[model samples]
Target chain A: MTGAPQDPADAEACPVAPTLWLRLEADGTYRVGLTTTAARRAGAIVHYRGPVAGRAYAAREPAASLESEKWVEHLALPLPGTVVEVNPLPTADPGLLNRDPEGAGWLCRVLAGPTDGRAAPPSVPTGAPE
Target chain B: MSLEPSDEARPGRLPSWRLLDLGRCAPARAQAFVEAVAVSVGEGRVPNTLVLAQPSAPYLSLGFHQSFHEELDPGFLERRRIPVLRRVEGGGTTYLDPDQWFFQLAYRDEGGGRGGPEDLKRFLRGPVAAARSLGLSAELRAPSDLVVGGRKVSGNAGGDWEGAHLVVGGFLLGADVRAMADALRLPHPALRPLLRGLVAREVTSWEEAVGVRPPWERFRQALASAIATEGRFEARTGAPTPAEEARFLEETLPRHSDPAWRELPPAPRRAGSLVRRLRIAGPHGLLVFRGSGEHLAAIVDGDRLVEAYRVGDGPTDALEELGEDGDGRAAVAELVASTPSFA
Candidate 1:
């Protein structure tokens, strides 16, 4: 699979936080998606979830959501940042990730950096890999 | 500001938060009340609050994540004066009436944690504190329920909004235990245990608690005190903003009351199974079946002809199909007929 395109123009687009397990690739790019730990705690995936383009998100805020059979849970941002790119397909069929989470399930991309310089996103605690 | 000063300098105790006693409104109104309260707080138009409303007639209420069939006899409820309504939160079934005083709290999600457990704890403390304000000792046992002296007084449930707005509420007024027991179709396993032991332990009301019918004023006083102390509310009254009201009505209300939305099971494979011969006969002839746990898939007509077969291995689709238009049997028949010939 081709690596996600890196665009300097995308970097300054809008801010979003990582709602699941995600990080910045060493080449100054972002890799954001849901964590396995979060999936189990939420029970089962039942409905649609995705993100909005051109919208800024704070760290730990939900840019998207996944519904279980009974309840729907939001995927919070892992790091404070901006959305530079988004895969529109997941919103139509969120279960894709819930079913085969490790691949083809990545939710969105964000330009990682604190907007307004309030505070950096909280680092995931040890053993917090859910 | 000075820590202490003359009478003018010292702020007097705030008056108790005003309570809107919705005395026996129609089922629709009871629902409207919930929507009004939720929309008001959810959109930040209203501060934290305690809303007490009593529907004039009986109604079956289901939690956000609850299945309608699990708790209510829809036909029976419809036949009777009761209305079957759904709420925008999670929890078990609650049977409501004039004798019961419904308590609701729409508040900001200020809990120090996140997810179900965090929200549950944050929401529960409000009512327990309310009960305490009313002069009753209350405690939150394991999970997300409130109890007084081993007997449950209130049950609470709600979801986190952006991990910010969380609405948690329950019934504190007296419940008609026998009627509720009868109206609700408790899952057999749960019922069997209740019939045997916990049933006796589950107590119902202020009457049971204080050995007399609780004075409405007293209950109100207690509820107000608790909410004022533990929750946040402005001393103003008005309808929720149009945007918030529209959202609740559009997004929240329909999701709750629609049977198709309410009873849709999460997964078809996990459904339970049972076969019962209704007294009424059907054109398809006598039915017999082999089903997956709870889903009816293949059935034999009177002559033992395989009349129905579901194409899928599990009941996920069946969950959505169950109560919709009340065509569970037809869907079952369709499922059976559609199955591959070998099975």
Candidate 2:
């Protein structure tokens, strides 16, 4: 978890969830991306339905969805916050979602409030998910 | 993105499922009802439930993340009067008929870092157990499948919808491989034969797997029992609460049947792309055609394009630029041009 802001805080898969990777920018905005393991387990990434910018999602509430040939997964941010921006590349180009999930395929930018009812979960271990 | 296993997640089971055995129904009704139950359970208005249903007739359904135009030939369905309903669960396009027995479940998402290979096996344990009871040597396959004697016996999908974890799957009592493949939109003319053959080798039905097709009643009962026991649910057979019923009749049903929902972009449209994506099932991936007033970008967005097949030209029309390869694009273009409000 290099360059992590505080900690990753998604509700669906953690107390120390590996489902999403979070990074903090200098402006207090958080960059969120799906972890590689979650992407691989989803099989082939075919479609992405991300949150509408400006919509507020409670901690763990699904902020986006990733669809594969066999399954569909609703994605949630680790901390409760409002989505400030969403990357449009993955929605148009589904390949990046699988090939560079934590890098170029980052999902959204969220701004978390101090008392958003949920705290950041611990950082994903350096070894990460297989 | 640690894909490693952890023992920290609390072991919790899904709540008891109130079994709603709608004896037989129109395909849309079955889809709508499952959605109703999911919304109710997710919203905490109704108990967690398992639905047993059979469509009275044949129909086509698209998964939530599937673009209707991408996966199917709409005019073909319209001419045949085949109804298409888009379900919330994400998967590939599916063909449903009375010969298949459908089961859907919805429960409170007791979040504990689920959705790994092991979690998929855990979720499908009941179905695997149920299939074996019917005398097929069924086993749970990794990443969402139930196979019997090496052929897939069921199609299942899982996801969070309306705040609840929903699981949907079905047992094929009989399969019409040709119809199943034909119902889909193909990117190239050459793939038709391959399509049917591919489907035949991959899927199996009860009639094909076992010596005889067990009576639907017998199989349905077995499914309910296995699911209840394995899911740790009591299996109370009943109906949705009044609120759930109201939402179904008013909200869910209408939305399922609405053309707007059926034709929605499986994925959100690219920012600034004018017209909706005109997509078709290519041999290797999704072939997408996005055309605005004058510009059209043809790209296969998913897997690499193994081979390029050009759709030379179509009849002169608003969307004819999409080209005609004797597949179905020409027909789709004509349909789109004639319709006053083409997406």
Candidate 2: give the clashing pairs.
A9-A78, A10-A78, A13-B113, A128-B2, A129-B1, A129-B2, A129-B3, A130-B3, B70-B279
Model 2 CA deviation exceeding 4 Å by range: A1-32, A35-46, A52-63, A76-84, A92-103, A110-130, B1-15, B109-118, B266-343
Q: Score the docking of each candidate (DockQ).
A: 0.07, 0.23
Candidate 1, B1-343: lDDT as tens digits: 1111243233553322224455556665555455555444544454444566666777766654344564465444666756666554554566667766666554544312344445566546766776666556778764555666766666665554433333445555675665655555522222222222322345456656755555666765666655655543323333445665575566555554555544543221222242222100111221223455443433333323333322223423332223324465565655445432211
Instruction: Tell me how many clashing residue pairs each candidate has.
Output: 27, 9
TM-score of chain B of each: 0.60, 0.72
lDDT of model 2, residue B211: 68
Supply the global lDDT for candidate 2. Answer: 0.64
Instruction: List model 2 lDDT by residue over B178-290, tens digit each.
Output: 78877877544434454565567667888888868878788889889998887776576777677777768877777776777677655545444223232222111223333
Q: How big is the positional error of residue B40 in model 2, measured in Å on the Cα after superposition?
A: 2.8
Q: Distance from true position, residue B308, model 2, in Å?
A: 14
The candidate that achieves the highest DockQ relative to the unseen native structure: 2
Docking outcome class, model 1: incorrect
TM match of model 1 to true structure: 0.54
